[model samples]
Target: MIHITLPDGSRKPFEDQPTGLAVAKSISEGLARECVAMEVDGQLVDLNRTIENDAAVRLITTRDPEALEIMRHSAAHVMAQAVMHVYPDAKLTIGPVVEDGFYYDIDMQPLSEEAFPEIEAEMKRIVKAKIPVERHEVSKANALEFYKNEPYKTEMISELADGTISFYKQGDFTDLCRGPHVPHTGFVRAFKLMRVSGAYWRADQSKAQLQRIYGTAFFDKKQLKAHLEFIEEAKKRNHRKIGTAMDLFSFHDDAPGMAFFHPKGMAVWNALLDFWREAHREAGYVETKTPIILKRALWEKSGHWENYRENMYTTEVDDEAYAIKPMNCPGGMLLFGTRPHSYRELPLRVAEIGLVHRHEMSGVLNGLFRVRSFHQDDAHLYMMADQIQSEILDLLRLEEKMYSQFGLDFHLELSTRPEKSIGTDEQWEVATEGLRAALDAYGRDYLINEGDGAFYGPKIDLHIKDALGRTWQCGTIQLDMSLPERFDLTYVGKDNEKHRPIMLHRTVFGSIERFLGVLIEHFAGKFPLWLAPVQAVLLPINDDLIPFAEKVASTMIQAGLRVEVDDRTESLNRKVREAQLAKTPLILTCGGKEKEAGTVSVRTLDGSVHYGIPMQQFMQQVTAHVAERRLELDLFEK
Candidate 1:
């Protein structure tokens, strides 16, 4: 007999060679139908795999989280099979599951989006057939011989050290994979082909170019419908589209990925920076500026030349190599080393809004979200070991206060040490624990992301949610012990002996440009009065009332409101429509009646109109609203 321990710690004695499916069948027919895969001694495997020894097992049903990935993997195979059915000349390379979806790369003739319907129909036919997916192990030599016609598969097999390779087969289609897929093709209930793009074989530019098909899958038809709806909504909220419509920013072919902020865009940028400076001031931080270019020797000592050289741009100056700064930490380190410190000055906080450059691939260069040149709101803190936890708590509090100002909701994630990292194991443990302790003290639940930290230390990431329920990673706090050691930074201890101070690297806005992009989508270009590029616009009913409109605009501008005058020879309704399209918060109109009464008619973005408001009271109310930085407009409220 073989003993099997379940997830709930129940032991069941089974006869020799009992399979996971047999166990599920013994429990209940409904469970057996729902079970798509099983975990045998912590390793996910096919439900038909025989249990030969005593071990713990967990049956994965369709409702479990892991089941989705299993189903998606099966869906990828089904997609590949469907493509082969439609186009037998296509050669498969590889398929893998990505965040929220899956993709498969195949060498085939270039096709457009119009071909998606035919391929999808074939995929649905395969799923309805319910062909059983079987896994088998073959010798390496046999695998190479079996894939002799497939160059990509043969090349992959040549690199593997294992003597036996795994392959999954369904119906007349077979592929090379190490997978824990669903029991059959029918498990892929609902799936859609999202798009087709050009990709180089194995992601190498020199290799053969292939067509990559992207897709997503879900268990229920309703879930698939919801996902498609979200995608459509996101397309409508795209910052690039909204930014151009509002005339706030633009990108040029000459600059490639750099943004050109117009005068109106600069207004929004200045407001955000001003707010950041004020909050940092209250948090006891002193701001500083650093050089945009530094010597290559400095980066070598900081370890970036060895690990991050590919992403850096370099040039020769004065017979020496120099690099445009890709990060602000090394320069901040140099500044810290310029002066000696005492324990009394411990926990010293320094901030910088530095512009840096990175050579990002053209494929990933998004509008402002992923750019070549951007500003990072970086701050570094030097403190004693005992001050680590308390300082982290303070940083968390500051982050919360700043994000709340934007009306954004956020969650915490703790990322531990990465594989390609510096510092000793002990240092990494201490750094990770310090952040963990601070998060615990903050009284919020956080998720652990294994091996996703910075090169120097573990970190905490703040992912903020937008209005559409999508999360954006905007803030991070990393604890570093290696940089201090590398830079030989020191401070006098209480006993008058020198000691190395620990460093904490953090940023509330990971990139100001990216945060601005997030804000654009979060508010759908409808900014609050204070953050609006043009807070209010004045429209005269006719040419005769232009003087009164100009007078009112001057008064509002002097009162610190961003006011504009519509001096165009357009009708009042046309001017109002244009202003509304521009997302102006306040629309003020002056006519013969209002001009004679020393008043103006007020209109807001929400189509609310109030008549005959005195100019003086209007200016006062607008000024107060901006000064308070109110997220909502309560103007003309009784």
Candidate 2:
């Protein structure tokens, strides 16, 4: 007899070994019908797999979060089967589920969007067949024999250390996999082939090129439709398209993966820096600047030469090798070591808007989001051991304030030490615990990501969600014990004894350029009044009203607002449309009626107009909105 424990603390004794599906049927037929997979002893497995010994089990149905991945994995197999049915000569490489979808790499004639319809139809036919999926384990010799004609599978088998390998089959199709897939083909009810792209076999460019087919799956047609709609919305909000339309920034062949900011874009960038400076100054931080090129030996001392040399851009200068800065922590450490400090100055905060360069792959060079050169809004806080919690709390509060200012919602993740990290285990534990305790006291939910920290220490990362529901990692607070020891940084304690200070590395905006890219998409280039390059534009109804428009522009400019006048040989309507397209916050019009009355007609971005407002009153409302950095035009009554 075998005893099986359930999530609710219930146990059942079976006379013989039973499959997970059999156990589910014993509890309730409805559960058996809905369940697609099972978890035995915390390991997900096929429902039809036998359970021979006492263990805890949980049935995974469509309602469970884990079911999506299971369904997607099954969909990948179904997709592979469909491809084989259509093109018998096609060779399969590998298929796996990724974020929001699954993909299969195949060695066949490159497929375009034109082939998606037929492939999708074949997948539907397979789903309609409702074929049962069977799992089998075979010895290494038998596995090799089964896949003798498949080079990819043979290569994969040679790398496996297990004596026996697993394979899954449905109908005439079979593939090597370690799966917790849905029970049968019918479970992949709603799916769509997204796109086809080129990917080198094994991700090596020198290897044979393969066609990668990307697709997504959902439990029902309604869910799939909703997800497709969300994808469409994301495309509309893509930063590259919006940035080009707004003429904010551009990328050129001469400077690939680097952004050349226009005047208007620089206006927004400077505004962000101004806000950062004010916040840091109020929080008792002193800003500093460091050389962009430092000797290679300095990086070796900081461990970057060993762990991060590949990403660095190095050059020879004065018969010595120097590297462009990839991180600011090392420079900050050297600055701290430049002067001896007493205990009174232990909690010193040094901030820098440092320029950094990294050698990103050409294929991954996204606009500003992934760039070779960018500015990091970085800071390092040196404090005593006992001050860790308080200092971390302060940084968290500052992070909250900065993100909230842009109306961005963010979630926290605590990442622990990685495999290639420096420092002793005990040192890492203390540093990680200090961060965990601070987050606990902050009274918010956070996730733990193992082995995702910096090379020197653990960190708390902040991922901010944009308007289209996509999340971007923008802020982080890292606790480091290695840099201090590497640089021999010290301060005199109260007892007149030299002691090492703990270093907390942090950044509210991990990179200014990337954050601006996110913000561009978040606002759809319709920035708020204060952050908008041209806060207000004055349009004359005719050339006769040019003087009045110029007067209004001068008044706004005097009030410290970014104002412009449109005196071109164009109609009022055309000028207004241009301003609207430019995403200017306010459009002010002055004509004969308003010129006589010393007033102006105010038109907002949303097309609501307040006519014949006194100049003084209009100035007051606009000034107030800019002063408060209001995201919406609430200061003016519509």
Candidate 3:
């Protein structure tokens, strides 16, 4: 008898060998019908695979995370089959599931949107056939011989050492793959071809170009519908689209990765920076500025040469090389090394709004989110060993306070040291323990991201949630002990002996440009009053009230409000519409009746209109709202 354990911790005795399919049927017909694949001892495998020993098993259905991946894998096979049916001469390579979906690489005629529909029709026909997917294991020699005529497949086979390879067959088509696919083709009920983009074979620029088909799949109709709707909604809220409509910001080819801050964009940028600076100051930070370009020797000494040289841009000046700073830490290190200090000055917090440049692939650049040039709201703390935990907790508290003001909730990631990291195990252990103690003191739970830290030390990363339920990594705190030692930074202790200070590098905004992009999407361009490019627009009913409108705008501007005068020769309704579309938090309209009475009509963005409020009271309320930096408009409820 073979012992089998289910995910729920129940054990079953199966005589001799039993397939996962038979095991599922023994549990329940409903389970057997729904299970598309099985997990055997944490590895995904075909349902027909026989188990002869004691192990745990999991029946993956349509609702599980792994279920979507399997469905996409099967869909890729179906797509390949469709391509083969249409063009038998085309060579197939690899197709893998990615974060959002899957893509199949094929060497054939260049693909266009025009060629997609026919291929999709063939795929639909294949899906309707409900063909069974069969998996078989074969020796590598036989596998190579099977696809000997296909150069790419033969090349791949030559790369594989002597081992068994798995191949999946559906109908008359077969492909080399490791799959735990859906039971039958009928399960691919909903899928769509998204786009056709250029891709170099094997992602090697020197290799031949291949046509890659991108598609997404889901278990059933509802999930597929929701995904499609999500795409539409995301398109509507895309920064590229909404930024132009709301006059937030723009990009030009003349200065790639450099932000063009329009008046509105500048207003929002200043608002965010002001908030960040205030929070940092309150959390005991003193800000400084670092040089944009530094000697390459500094980076070499900091070990960035061995790790981050590829992403760095270099220049020759005075017969020596200088690097456009990719990060601010090295410069901060040099600044710390400039002079000796006393232990009494230990736990010093230094910050800088430093602009750094790193090379980003041109193809992947997306507005402000991925850029080559951006400013980091960076800070470094020189703290004593005993102050590590408390200092980190203070930083955590400030991060929470700042993000909460933006109405953002965040997730935490604790990344451990990498394999090629500097510093001894003992040093790393102490640093990591300090980070954990701080996290515990602050009562913050985090997910471990193994092997995802800097070359110097482990770190904590914070990912903030947006309105659409998507998360962006905005706030971060990283503990580093290596840089101080690298730069030979020292401070005199109370005992009059020199000692290296622990460095805690942190950023509330990892990249200001990226954070701005996320903010635009999170608010859907409806900026809060304090951050809105125009806090209030003064609209005159006609050219007759232009003088009064201008006077009110001047008064509001003098009161430290961003007020705009809409003195156009347009109707009141038209001006109101413009203000509403502009997302101005407040619209102050003056007409013959209101201007004569020395009162103004207050119209907030949420469609609440209060008629005939005293100008003094209106100014007081608007100033109060702006000063508070409320994330939401506190307009009176209708």
lDDT-better candidate, 1 vs 3 = 1
Residue by residue across 96-149, what tens digits does model 3's lDDT show?
A: 998668889999988887877998899999999999999889999899889989
Candidate 3 residues lying further than 4 Å off, grouped into runs, are: none
**Full-model lDDT for every candidate:** 0.92, 0.92, 0.87
* Position 20, candidate 1: lDDT: 86
| Top lDDT hit | 1
| Model 2 lDDT tens row, 1-638 | 98999999999989999899989998999999889999999999999999989999999999999999999999999999999999999999899999999999999997998999999999999999999999999998899999999998899998888698999999999999999788889999999999998888886878999999999999999999999999898777777888887778999999999999988888888888988999999999999999999999999999999999999999999999999999988888889988889999869999999999999877678889999999999999999999999999999999998899888999999999999989999999999999999999999899999999999999999999988778999999999998999999999999999999999999998999999999988998889888988888988888888887887888889998988899999878999999998888889888899999998888888889988898898888889888877777775665
Minimal lDDT window, size 10, model 1: 198-207
Better of 2 and 3 by lDDT: 2
Better of 1 and 2 by lDDT: 1
Candidate 2 TM-score, C-alpha based: 0.97
Sorted by lDDT, highest first, which candidate order results? 1, 2, 3
Q: Please write out the lDDT profile of model 1 over residues 5-46, one tens digit for every residue.
A: 998899999878788898898789999988899999999999
TM-scores of the models, in the given order? 0.97, 0.97, 0.95
The positional error of residue 634 in candidate 1, measured at the CA in angstroms, is: 3.0
